[model samples]
Target: MTRKAAEPSRRQPGPRRDKEPLHCIAACGREVDIGTCVIRWDQPGSLVCPNPRGRSACTRHDPRLNDAPTLPFSRYRIHNPDQAYEELKKTVHQFVLHYDVCWTSRHCHQLLADSPFKGSHFYLDLDGTVYQTCDLYWKTNTAPADDGLGNERAVHVEMANLSWQARAEESGLHLLQTDAYRKTDAGWLLNLPAGRRQELRLQSFQPLAARAYGDRGYFSRKINGRTVRMWDFTEAQYAALIRLCRGVHELLPRVRLQVPWDPEQRRTPLDRLPGFSRFEGILGHAHVQGGNKNKGIKRKYDPGSAFDWGRLRRALSR
Candidate 1:
């Protein structure tokens, strides 16, 4: 009732080479040097194409040779897995080769350096003072009883003093501290601007007031043929006063100011007294003007002097 199907016969492969340096093709009988050829197919543990060219062979025995699969879709190709993988890695490396290219332009190098991820840094010395945004006084706040002193009695200078000290420290400003003015056992010494010591030496004339008043701070001398005033300190004037003296008088050009020190013993309150009474011997005046020399130069007074309107304005601005 049913026709029987024929059974297929199994084929065993030929003998293998014994220590041979080269191989030969099965169909074409072409000799393939070991260096130029590799194994292709296999059947039951025996090689089908004993030798294979780098390229696929011409179609004679290959049943699907005319329609062979290509790289993107191929499944049956006998490619050397090691060589194929190496070639893939080399292609990727060449594609990314620009990473190793040295930066020759200054701007490009700077751009690379500026990346925040790289972690680099530097610093600068920025200068100048930050002024208060608004004016403050006792009249503005009704915390105290009214006195004839008006706003002066209500004024608390401590806040201003504290603010200045804080800002100076935070900003790295070269402000002199109150402690620097306190009297020490050391002689009345302070820092001087460079070369001012030389200027002091060159203008060697002593002020007559120094001798007449018996004040260690008075140097009422003439410099560059111009009238000048000088003062001696009692350690409370602060060290910065010393530099200010040198800067205004000897270092900078054509700067004149009230004598920073006095032959007379003085305090900040001494100036507020009547006739400047308690300040009598403690305070001496210098006629800071160009006499025969700087007749055109004007006198500059200290901050709290009766004649110091300009100084008051400067303080208010600060």
Candidate 2:
């Protein structure tokens, strides 16, 4: 069961009122003083004064208006991939990866824009080009409530593509179409190949790349009274991912190569952990989805059973 990406919110631009002086357009309903307020356009075509007083502003309007000194990776990295890489080297402790599981890059961007969740530092398009959306060093709202790992400390990467079910049908991959597993108390535990699991574990780097689903779980859609978990990353995607990981490792030598999941234990080590700020490595969303002691369960499987970990490992090794 695959779900279509939500259409981007299209709000009609408010009429420009030049006669009125600029005020704080936020819901706070405060009149901004030009002498102290920092004026900027937060939403499209909406000029707003984020700071009404001389004090700090709210993040709901702009995330960058905080009092903290700017780090090297503070700027958006969309067009400057090299600069983004260099900046991330100085401060990034963890590199998290996620599949857009949506349609096009435009759709992915729109989804992120409308979502309450903060966008990832970089986005990998189907053509293998990596685009930066946010600062690598900035903490994001990707983590669950009170889970601790978020934009403040981790770097996130999103890969734009379709979900596993749609991709499998289009590509004629029968293995992914099989319904061999059942939903359990823990979640939908997938019976993936051991060889593939080993491959994923081996390719992981330190601190692990956290999957977005780790905290919130997998997004599922029901079809014909059956629940389906979808995730399909292409071979080209894997190649690009390997290159990205290698580049990250070259810059941050202290980062380890390891998955956060404990295959023997069949669970994530960070599930109940207080925070991920001190830990450094690469982990997937699946490793963090169930939460500590499986307290807050959302998704059970992601990067799904068909993700080609062996191929990724082989490519990285070469």
Candidate 3:
């Protein structure tokens, strides 16, 4: 089953998308249905994931792929659904979450597309439009947890959120003169520049964080030995994410509808997991990586402090 996506909010979008959901992703001549609105690599105006090193069982972070031609989605190298599904099921066990630290999914994709090798399997936009850059049969170089073998067992989603960058003092990569979110009569709206307004599927969309903490309209907490302060994800993102999680679980059972919960703490832990590499569920990048320079894994903290892990847990439970 699939949910046919409604039209973009304003002017017609380019590279035309399937007005009707194909309900499946194409790869190696096989397609698996995922019941959601996903802009695929084959779609017009797609922000395609780059550098397919190889299939699920054959990936190993090949530098050579940086220069390799990204094959069309319709012509993925694998040609057998049974073999592809079996390999994917065994290889992918965790769904890794991230806050893209960008204004929208298009911005996030621009950064990835410019990089020699960085890419994500999915991008959850501010308006909750999910962009599937490539087939789930391939591995993306999004998060390489402590064991350095994380890519082998995880698929990734780069949800749009500036994270700590929402604040001027904490902003780094995408420096901001002031806070990225502005408080309005309506709510705490992200100050998306007018120039980038068209990036969203909903031109009139107000990118408000679903929840906020106190007067500042952002959440401040410690995660992975550092202070992270940011606004919550949008309500639309939460709803779409839950649906996406359900679809992912249906398609790949091992990547269960669960997050990193600390039973004693009575909430999800916002730090690297001790059994990080062994866990089998949806989790934030912070849950698996506490940067070790010697080990070559930079510290990661994403799907940050403002993310509602408990809310996600409750929603998934149903």
Please provide TM-scores, in order, for all candidate models, with all chains considered together: 0.15, 0.47, 0.87
Ranking 2 against 3 by TM-score, winner: 3
Q: TM-score of the candidate numbered 3?
A: 0.87
Residues 11-96 of candidate 2 have per-residue lDDT tens digits of 23576476543322111111112111112234232211111110121122234533243323323223333443344444555666
After superposition, candidate 1 runs with Cα above 4 Å error: 1-185, 202-318
At residue 54, candidate 1 shows an lDDT of 22
Error of 3 at 239 (Å): 0.7
| Model 2 residue-pair collision total | 33
**RMSD of model 2 against the true structure:** 17.5
Residue 198 in model 2: shift from native, Å? 37
Q: What is the lDDT of residue 295 in candidate 1?
A: 33
lDDT by residue (28-115, candidate 1, tens digit) is: 1112121211222221212211111121121122334223221121232423433432232222100000010111112112332344
**TM-score top scorer:** 3
Model 3 agreement with the true structure over 60-176: per-residue lDDT tens digits:
324334234665444444455556666777778899999998889998888887876678988988887888888777778888898777877888899999998889988887788
For model 1 the TM-score comes to: 0.15
